[model samples]
Target chain A: MKKIIAGAAYVVGDAIDTDQIIPAEHLVYSLSDAEERRYYGRYALSGVPQGQQGLPYGDRPFTAPNAFRSEYAIVVGGSNFGCGSSREHAPFALQEAGCAAVVAESYARIFYRNAVDGGFIVPFESIERLLERVRTGDLLEIDTSLGKLSNRTTGEEFLLKPLGDVADILKAGNVFEFARQAGFMPA
Target chain B: MTITEKILARRAGRDRVAPGDNIWVDVDILMTHDVCGPPTIDIFRREFGADAAPWDKEKLVIIPDHYIFTKNHHANRNVELLRAFAAEHDLPYYYDPGTPNYKGVCHMALAEEGFNLPGSLLIGTDSHTCTSGAFGMFSTGVGNTDAALIMGTGKIWLKVPETMRFVFEGSLPPYLMAKDLILQVIGDIGTDGGTYRALEFDGEAVYDLPVHERMTLTNMAIEAGGKNGIIPPDEKTFEYVRERTDRAFEPVYGDPGARCHSVRRYRVEEIEPLVAKPHSPDNRATVSEVAGTRLDRAYVGSCTGGKLEDFVAAANILRGQEVAIDTYIVPATTWIGEQLHSTRVEGDTLYEIFERSGCKLGQASCAACLGGPSDTFGRTHGSEVVISTTNRNFPGRMGSKQASVYLASPYTVAASALSGRITDPREALV
Candidate 1:
């Protein structure tokens, strides 16, 4: 049985980019396996203290640290999630940081395709329930195959159904492998 | 056939195509970058089981464009990993060459190096990859995984897009450049008007414009939700390719009888300085609407805005006046930077004029426009509004989430930097 080991959950506001997930200045480290925590820090509201109010930083629902600190199989976010360049680094960085999935209200088209192709799970979860059950650092178990998300804190279970072709890609371990099974290539 | 129709036909297995055809065609050329390549490579190798890689190494071009100029050690190491992978895979065009390192920016480097052949279909991992369409190729941006799959298979599928033709008939006004012209087009079409379509530019205006100017027109085609924007090959096209490449020239043109779904024309003299306000590129307003607005930073860099003509235009405007307090200008590519640095115009390079006017130059690599590590607006305590010469100005694109970014041409950005407020270059140009 394939299982999702939920870990720390780091919540973020809308409109995150690959550069903020990992700055362009960090492009030099493409080959290395080093980990980047708070890679999206520069673009975060709390990250830039002084200019916090001018942009839509304060009203964003995901700024609370305790909500994002948890280790989980799923990371939930607001609408228009990952809306910018087709940079694949955004989803890759999140998955590498121990996030098995990113459940958001919406996703940029390119980012959506890149995520599924990389074997990372990006599902659109209930923004309301996701905001309520998970806080930073609380472990939650998500079984996409089973479509269940359990909040360990309150013993609450949330239903999740993978939409579109994302579920198929995740099940096959990535797009290329799926292609191979589909006879896209000669063995 | 025109260069565009020829290229599309080669992929579509048809001599010609009309608008509104739902057809899947094969990608002609594919590209990737280091950031997304490693993972895609990992997936590719796993799926293929490593006995043999999927695609021809020569056809795959991978370079590190995002963090080529980095202060971070980790990011630098990542680049090294990619370099090693390129070598291991025997990828021919593996590195970027220039003063800060490579010739300048990747797209410009590719253009100058002649990797972009006319009538070829090009794809890359960055959205700005469409910049190459200036060379009269069908180029667009995709995800790393998509690129990796193409790397392994040597082919990918794409839905043939309907092409919308824009005909420009007259010469541009003294102050307006290609950037202004694109803004005018976008404003007319509105965002989402061309969603999932191709924009084919024609008429005397497009043919008369320079190569770099053509690039500016096509680069923003993505902003209009276009798959690829193209200009048919002509005498100018042949000249550009002959100068940069050794490949035997093959002239491609769209048939005069080639069917176009929609056609529209504009007089170049009718356009004005335009700006795409925050949140969307389609949210356009004339420069007159936003002029005199104070700015914290006036950036003139990015694939769309960074070019020799752009640099010359900005330098001409700021030649006598000093940049207002807190204004910064960054050239998009290192080659452009060096060109500006070593270039001698009136006893000085454009860099000299920019530096003398209280402005400091940032390196190439999409700096400032995409928000580099050191470049930020609003100081540490207060928020700032930036008027950039780049293509996009969506929220949080420049630096802070709170900062307001207004997109314009190099002329407008430079004029604003001089006057300490957004102003059209037409008013200040003599």
Candidate 2:
């Protein structure tokens, strides 16, 4: 796995829960065949406020139809990201949506584990200052090997926690795959 | 070491284990419900080969509770998948819907069926799997892949969590319930305060609470980011388990000098009814702080609030009074609904109370808690303001993003339903 990746950031506020990531009404699609699972990515941030008056990014959905062109490879969040529910679909949706990493001041424990176990996306823990240093469209660079996050746009840099075993899991493409490599599963 | 440490150390076959130590341990039971089960089965078949069988069929319990009663094709398909999987696998513990062997919510049904034995390590696909910890077991929720992995290997790797002790003293006030106490704790600790930590609840108030009420405390630990919430077993736990199952088990307890990461105390006498306002479980406030707020709906049901005692509390308030707002009452299990039909309080059965108050009674399943399909009864639609007994109040939790949800106790919800506003239960009790 490459230790460094850079892209535009999609910023969200605190306590963005599983319900918002993917509502229960859409869970049936999650159980469908592989082709249908893309709906999870399509509706990743469906619950996020869009086109609401007096909020940031008015009239623009978080992940618009042209989101691939916008290229939000990273998601930055405030405290307690993924706070409710143990659904892996939260991270699955983000991974399907082309999000490579999530940097947050803090995260719900279950979400962190699901991200690692599924090897869906990288989860980074940053200080509260990171939220202030980066904006929605800011080009940010994260280097997991060096535990550093550099803001390519502003030339500012911040520190990130090391990935530890999580990097190995992601390199192996998920826990089950890693288990097979480590001889925990049938060869 | 704390009780959690002791249990983990034993299961991992270690002399001593501390927080942050990752070790693989054998699981006693694995629970999966309709919504999460299909994906889990998919992963199991995909990863382990379609010809592979479960490691232990008896240890895997599948209950179709979330989308059972709904009319949606997809929702019903999830159940059908589970049913076919159970039939193919010959799984003995599968609780089918609309059958004599059907159970209610997986958490409560696990308890009623004696799967919540003390000193056991239980995992479920649903977040409220901590509800089993009320029986002195080490239980927590995991994602679909982890559940499927356990279904294949019957073992999982877990990082040991540090323990936080919360002691509650003094007797609870008449109107104050366990729901208020947990909401107060979550508010104080913030949503992520207990991240990767075990919450050990003790003290006079917790011990005095009924087993059902104690289950409420453990059930909400996940809301505070707890790995698991546990209560030491006592006579109440033993009697409850004995009545449900004849299985013999030893109870685990924390040592007197157990090392704790932090210790917090609360006085039950000083506590008051509380509510988690719209959009967040930690956005808590006193019922008085938001009193007289008009409501369009009042819902009482879920693993957190749909127990027999919860219905009894609401019945006490709605017996003679007519509901001013649309009220939905759902029992957590079929047995609870049957109890409502067979038992009477103050010469009026719970069914009669629902009839007299014009409340819509629902089957024993997680009806409106997860914002079921469009046809699901009592689901919030449009911009209606609702007072619910369900756990989460996040946007679109019950149904519509335009709707606002306030989480409270059954007493508070019932009282509010009577007046079409958020009224404290004490006023109704008076």
Candidate lDDT scores, in order, read 0.66, 0.87
lDDT of 1 by residue, B133-169 (tens): 8777888787767776777776654546677888888
Root mean square deviation (Cα) for candidate 2: 1.9
**Candidate 1 chain B, run of 10 with poorest lDDT:** B373-382
List, residue by residue over A1-187, the lDDT tens digit for candidate 1. Answer: 1566565454554444444454443333332233443443222223222232223333322233534222334566654455457766666655644566776655554566677766655555553536545554556677656667777766877776555445666678777767677666665
Question: Best-fitting candidate, measured by DockQ?
Answer: 2
> Tens digit of lDDT per residue, candidate 2, span B1-430?
8889888888888888999998888899999998889999889888999988999998999988988887788888889989999999899999999899999899999999999998889999999999999999899999998998999988888999999888999998879888998999999998888999999999999999999999999999998999999998999999999999887888888789898999999988998899999988889999999999999999999999999989999999999889999999999999999999877879999999888999999999998898878888788879999999889888989988889999999999999999999999999998
Candidate 1 CAPRI classification by DockQ:
acceptable
Model 2 C-alpha lDDT versus the unseen true structure: 0.87
TM-score of predicted chain B versus true chain B for each candidate: 0.92, 0.99
Interface RMSD, all candidates in order, equals 3.9, 1.3
Tell me the TM-score of candidate 2's A chain. Answer: 0.86
